[model samples]
Target: MKFFIKLCIVGLYSIPFAYLSVQTDYEADSKTNYIIMSLIIGVLSYFCGLIRADLPLIFGNIISFSVSYFCNSIAMLDKKRADFFTPINSVEQIVLITVMSIVIQVIFYKLARRFAKGYINIIESNNIEKEKRV
Candidate 1:
């Protein structure tokens, strides 16, 4: 259930990008690329959660954004647009996305932990009642 919730969160985060890709006359290939990138980010978040108490969603987003930026710059060069990477248009984009991802993941983690604890408590109570009957 926790994994399902996490997957939903990931899908929600990708929606804006998916919509933008469609609105901007983006090539089908580029749209597919973005989807693949998002999946990679989701997988990275999952692994990060395994090692840490909470998922480092913000860190994963930053890493994903940086890689995407680098790739975009390279693509621009291929088209003879620029020789180097351009500065990001909005620092706020990074801050907003990072904050949102972290907050959402933290909330989900807390809820999942609470649910798991409640499940264990119920099981323990049931065992205790059984023992009492015996």
Candidate 2:
């Protein structure tokens, strides 16, 4: 439940950036890309909790870069546009992607903490009930 909520929050946070990425390119539909990217980021962040340090950054960057590069390449090929090379455009693209990644991390961390607490409570209660039964 906590993870699901966190996933929802992270997924929601990513939507704007994904939409902006697609809108700036104006070739393919941004909404579809937004949903796909949000899901990818959310799922990755959720699983990232299971790993140790440095992995999240590496995984996030790899996923973000791959998606950005792929979308930019597709836009270039399909629309014959050169908007991605501009300094401001490049900055915006990086900023949005980075923001999306960070938001996912924050949401995941909060959710994981809440989940741990809930699990502890359940365990304690189970132990108490077992003691009473015995």
The window of 10 residues in a row where model 1 has the poorest summed lDDT is 17-26
Alpha carbon RMSD to native, model 1: 8.3
Backbone clash pairs for candidate 1 read none
What tens-digit string does per-residue lDDT give for candidate 1 at 82-112?
A: 3221353223333444455455555555555
- How well does each candidate superpose onto the true structure, as a TM-score? 0.44, 0.52
Every model: Cα RMSD to truth: 8.3, 7.4
For residues 11-128, write the lDDT of model 2, one tens digit per residue. 4443444435555545563446656666666655555453322343454455556565555555555433555346555445656766776787668756765676687899999999
lDDT of each: 0.47, 0.56
lDDT score, candidate 1, position 129: 100
Off by over 4 Å in 1: 1-91
**What does the lDDT read for residue 97 in candidate 2?**
61
